[model samples]
Target: MTRISTSIIYLILFFINVRFVKNQQTTNFSCEPRPTQADTTDKLQRLRAHLVNNNLFAYVIFSEDEHGSEYVQLYDERRAWISGFLGSAGT
Candidate 1:
């Protein structure tokens, strides 16, 4: 009856809202502030030095919590110190 019709309308609205939210989250990420030649060279040299100092044959990976529970700012230093990715989920 009227109650069932209202329930169907509510369900449709709920699904539409969910789809809109999901679409909003879809994004394409690109590196910002593209590094200058000198900056790139410096980063390369720093990476080399890190590898040499650590005697590492393979790149090291690191990660931080993505739950947004901890202070993500605190991990900025570690990200700067590392060569590879530093993310909440995957490194």
Candidate 2:
């Protein structure tokens, strides 16, 4: 498929996943022991240093993989790893 078509497909899937998650009932299952403010600050500092060393301006962390699937592998949880938000709806 063309790149544009592939992108459209992914976009559609992402919206569907979002809608599904939003419609779900809430539970008391929280992502416990959320990262502290200091932890986030430290993570950002380290990430900034890495970006500078690599000559990069910024980094984009997403909650989904290439296929826009909400159910991702552990390796694909960059958003949750960095932000400590494990929700299925938003990152």
* Cα shift from native, residue 88, model 1 (Å): 5.6
The stretch of ten residues in a row with the least summed lDDT in candidate 1 is 32-41
C-alpha positional error of residue 33 in candidate 1 after TM-score superposition, expressed in Å: 5.4
Name the TM-score of candidate 2.
0.43
lDDT tens digits by residue: candidate 2, 1-91: 9856765676666666655544554434544554553235457567757866796554656567878784799888877778666677543
Residue range 1-91, candidate 1, lDDT tens digits: 5845755665666556655543453334474544531224356466656755796433433344455345656555354444433344433
**Which portions of model 2 show Cα errors greater than 4 Å?**
1-38, 73-75, 88-91
**Candidate 1: regions farther than 4 A off:** 1-41, 59-61, 65-71, 74-77, 80-89
User: What lDDT is reached at residue 85 by model 2?
Assistant: 68
Model 1 residue 80 CA deviation in Å: 5.4
